[model samples]
Target: MTMTKKHLDSARRTLELEILALQEQLGQLDHQFDQACDLLLGLTGRVIVTGMGKSGHIGNKIAATLASTGTPAFFMHPGEASHGDLGMVTRQDAVLALSNSGETQEVTSLLPLLKRLGIPIISITGAPYSTLAREATLHLNASISREACPLNLAPTSSTTATLALGDALAIALLEARGFGPDDFALSHPGGSLGRRLLLRVADIMHQDQQVPRVLPQASLREALLEITRTGLGFTCVTNEQNQLLGVFTDGDLRRVLDLSLDLHQTRVDQVMTPEGKRVYPEQLAAEAVHVMEENKISALPVVNQQQQLVGALNMHDLLKAGVI
Candidate 1:
């Protein structure tokens, strides 16, 4: 085989091994997994994850996943726990220890102190009979038939299985806790998901003086001027009571131009899309996006419960807010 072909084969073999390892883990799930989730769910304090070496990296990610999903968690370095960091642990907290061998010295060494504190320990290990597993309050078997590493000496299929197990635990807990998108958005406010779930139309729309609007009797030329002045690409046509009568957009202008309508003589409402698609100020900006996409429109006039035009927003505004 060519060098490139050899490389591809190695990669494929590694993935296949990891896939089988995950399958084994899936079959290993039992009451122990259920009891572990119950313990985590009932905890009054945080989940403190600890490990050594490669296991430590996996532990850090598991802690973060647990934290972001709903269960409060943080990674604690086992070596540091031996050096006074054990003080961070309280009886209210639970320990999640990781060790493929089930006997990493740094991690196993902390088990005694954790037990003395009356803290519950949940261990994920390849060796079911190892010291850490035997000492744990609940043990999860992350065993794999062999490492994906060709020599079977390095951590490969083992870590993949452990990570998958960690994710399974996190998601199961998330579902049990009834964690929903809004709750997730609270923890991820800076991300696009948060913007989609949390952002409201009122938060991004132009209001009052900034809103481009013209009286229904206003000439098409005047509406065009209003659209230009606000740069919102559209203007709302309303009456004396400020009730929305219609909306005229650049596309409407194109069609009107095609008809060769006299812009200065034509009433704004005569050329407007009567009672055009509208959105409420309190509605999610994501919902507004759906309306725009479904109707093939670029802008929406924000209205109140009484159907009075309150504000306006365009596709550009939603795009700028990262809700697009």
Candidate 2:
């Protein structure tokens, strides 16, 4: 069948209804929302999320959002909870249950056991006076005016409202706990943000024997040999005291060669870049990448507070370490 104006109009109406429902729910948040957040923030154990069907699917996403944003949480299917999964929760933990009607049998069936265990319950329900809401320690109203579905039978607007509320709770808790990007990176170690934040210069830089170094008095030819030996395409020009004086790279050599300078007699100091860009061992490799990018250079020497060269690194090193 050809897509027509009726279908288009119906789709637009559905989204408009959902948006209006979320706006209404946003207006409904009051002290109850704050109370739920306070309870979750005070928990010593993880937040246990439970629901049935669509709510369960939404709960899974909510739990993942919570976990990534500094809140320890996991979704436990309510049906599984009544069988034996209830053991996963303890008195120290808090439960956040979802049921638009606030009367889902599979979810409400765990009320007595949760009460016996003394675990605090925060219910997200459309029905304020339902059994689940009345029994909860804190009730968050996810009540929506109507479903986005034309039949008014599916959980379209209600689920969207619940998801938005879940996001609001997670972000509020994240800010209250002073959760920052570095802390978030810890929870996402395998992600690019973690690699950028956690990887340091010392972890990827070449140390000691791997560094190409030459005394300032060394001839350009000698520095060239050192660069070739280390395969770093550059050599650090240092004084007798081993303090970095300058850097001589292939680019410098090219410039010198164009000028017809005698490589065998020209001293390294004559062509070296004076006391150039440097990094520290404790600094993030990502910072090294920034420096390299800003200057359009491929290599850098790692130095200490005293300006002593401790290590060296290049673009290849960053790429190999997955920091680039």
Tens-digit lDDT string for candidate 2 (43-102): 899999999999999999999999999999999999999888988998899999999999
lDDT accuracy of residue 184 in candidate 2: 81
Error of 1 at 212 (Å): 1.1
- TM-score per model over all chains: 0.94, 0.85
Residue 278's C-alpha lDDT in candidate 2?
92
Question: Candidate 1: lDDT over CA atoms?
Answer: 0.95
The model with the greatest lDDT is 1
State each model's CA lDDT, in order.
0.95, 0.93
* Model 1 lDDT at residue 106: 96
Q: Write the per-residue lDDT of candidate 1 for residues 133-236, one digit (tens) a residue.
A: 99999999999999999999999999999999999999999999999988998899888888999999999999989899999889999999999999999999
**Residue 223, candidate 1: how far off, in angstroms?**
1.8
TM-score of 1: 0.94
